[model samples]
Target: MKKTIAGIEIPDGVMAQAATAQIRGTESELIFHHSLRAFLFGALIGYRESLTFDAELLYVAAMFHNVGLNVKYHRSPYRFEVDSANAARDFLRRHVVIDRLIDEVWTAIALHTTPGIPEHMSPLVALISAGVQMDVRGARYDDFTAQQCDEIVQAYPRESGFKRKIIEAYARGMEHRPETTFGTVNADVLDRWDPNYRRLNFCGLVLGSDWPN
Candidate 1:
């Protein structure tokens, strides 16, 4: 039987179970819990907004959203988000998921770290971002009622130092691929965490280009 939280039954099926199996134990308790909360929050938002989406797909995307932070992908040159998204893509493909839906999940994970853009895309994309933002920073903390919030957190509790720890997790994940964090939101992690890391100025890049100005 699938668990229910805040009146929402966690999506369950062979595929969903497979996704769960793939992520659990591979991720730290902190990151794993956050990922589950992200799915539940996204589901709650979808219910609140009456948005239609594939729960299974959203669940898979949420499960794999931060897997790039794992040690296996630490050597990947791309941003952690892209590595995570590709991980989901590969999983879905192994399950023979259709290209269209695979792309949707890919986009959701790849862009979850990106704020404004995902929210403007499809419901699946927007809800994925919404869920992640809510978990990572409480982007819409007050949107849900107290009961909803309590129920969700009750099902999956955020650790005591989640805010600080999550940033630490991001920093650890991308510290190896610092160059990838250059223009993305996670760059802030390296900026603050590593005193030696500095963001490359966009103006500097353009002006320093080979084009003789």
Candidate 2:
């Protein structure tokens, strides 16, 4: 029996099941619940916008979006977003999903942390970001009815101090590769948590570049 919340049913496809198993098994309880809520909230946003999208793909993307933050990939030099995207891409490829579809998921996960851009892309890309924004940033918290918010939370039950905990997760994931967080919102995590952290300045890089005009 598939579960339903906020008028959206969990995708019961084989791919979704495999993705769910992996996420639930490997991710911390906070992440696993957050992943579920991201999918639900994202689906609700899509429903509100009346945009057509593949829920299964969205589920898979949501499940893997924060995966790079896992301890296994913490040492990688790439951005956690790219690392997470790679995990989704590899999963999709192994399932014989087409290259085109894989790219959509990959791009969605890669750009989930980026604001102001995913909204202009495909529905899948846009909604994934919107969902993330809603869940983490409360981008449009009022857009959803109070009941919907209550329902989703009741279903997933966000742990205590989610904001701080999430920031800690991001900081831990990227502390070893601070360069990757240079120009993205992830840097905010380091700035807040890492007392010795120095942010990279884009203008400074520009002025100091070796290319002389």
Candidate 3:
């Protein structure tokens, strides 16, 4: 059941799996749509930039990148990113995927939220971050043409109130584990939804460090 969305091909193997269906079934409609958009946008970027990558790996990474936000994973002590990575690893292992490729996918999902680092890593990891950024914040919105954007959104429409919905999702996912949001965009959600939440100050930490100069 390979299908093309906005000119990007999603392989049948990736789409046919039970785990993929579980993701679609468990995740909210907004999250599921966002995941599809991430893969399409990532593939488009790779094509535009003439970058080579493993499409299946990138697809798997994009699809399962946010599973930690689901309620089933809320109790895990690890950060949402790590939980998502672990879920992807377990899914891949069940299918007998090679360890090396599983490791690559795990890295892509785990580091997708971190800034500055994934862009310099392997293509699978770099594209996952790139796609997430483009979808979430329009970080590279200009890289895609108007038609491309329109088509992608049409295939996986961002329903009305998407901004608020996604923010709520983020808040719910990280609220119980505020410590994990300290250095990432997840912090913004906590700051808004949890009034008592205080953001960490990198400058203050730097100044407070013991230095023997």
Candidate 4:
């Protein structure tokens, strides 16, 4: 159940499972459940500040952040921390770009559940993780008026249905493979949806990737 998004191939079923686990349970959210959101937040930051970074890492991080949630909940709240870190380490070990930071990436995944544990990866990871925290806590932007925050919250449900569909597609083995090697399906699909649906969508296109018009 794999699909390529923005040149990075993802296992959609695993993520879907994570999301289902998150919605039905309560102990801690699965890393995979919120991955797209994290990636979107990271992309937003990247676009606004002109930061240069690898979209692959952002996508990977988002896709697998809560992998530990696949397991049933335990009495201890921190159990998923190590589980997620190990899963992320194993997953990222296959990639060359993030190979050097495998240890750091694991640390980020493990510590992401633990607030106050500073992020060990690059600043981009930190920023994106923060955005994720904001989302989980339902925090509103300090700068935005109360009304604006209300509007955003009302218009966009906290849950992400597009990601669910994407994951379902992946589970069904529906993939978007480009005939040309030059373009990524994620980037292409996102580009088409950006102008029309950017406001309502929280896929986090602006987080750490460029959205070319």
Q: Name model 1 segments beyond 4 Å from true.
A: none
Instruction: Output the TM-score of candidate 3.
Output: 0.91
Ranking by lDDT: 2, 1, 3, 4
lDDT of 1: 0.90
lDDT of 4 by residue, 66-119 (tens): 554453422224344455567666666644434666765665555554555444
lDDT of 2 by residue, 81-101 (tens): 999999999999999999999
Candidate 1 vs candidate 3: the TM-score winner is: 1
Candidate 4 least-lDDT 10 residues: 173-182
Task: Give the C-alpha miss distance for residue 116 in model 4, angstroms.
Answer: 3.9
- Alpha carbon lDDT of each predicted model: 0.90, 0.92, 0.86, 0.46
Q: Compared to the true structure, candidate 4 yields what TM-score?
A: 0.47
Q: Which 10 consecutive residues of model 1 have the lowest summed lDDT?
A: 2-11
On residues 105-178, what C-alpha lDDT tens digit does candidate 3 reach at each position?
A: 99999999899999999888989999988998898998888988998898899989888888888889988888
User: Clashes in candidate 2: how many?
Assistant: 0
Q: How much is the lDDT of residue 77 in candidate 3?
A: 83
Tens digits of lDDT, candidate 1, 88-173: 99999999999999999999999998868988899899989999999888899889888988988888889998899999999999
lDDT leader: 2
Better of 1 and 3 by lDDT: 1
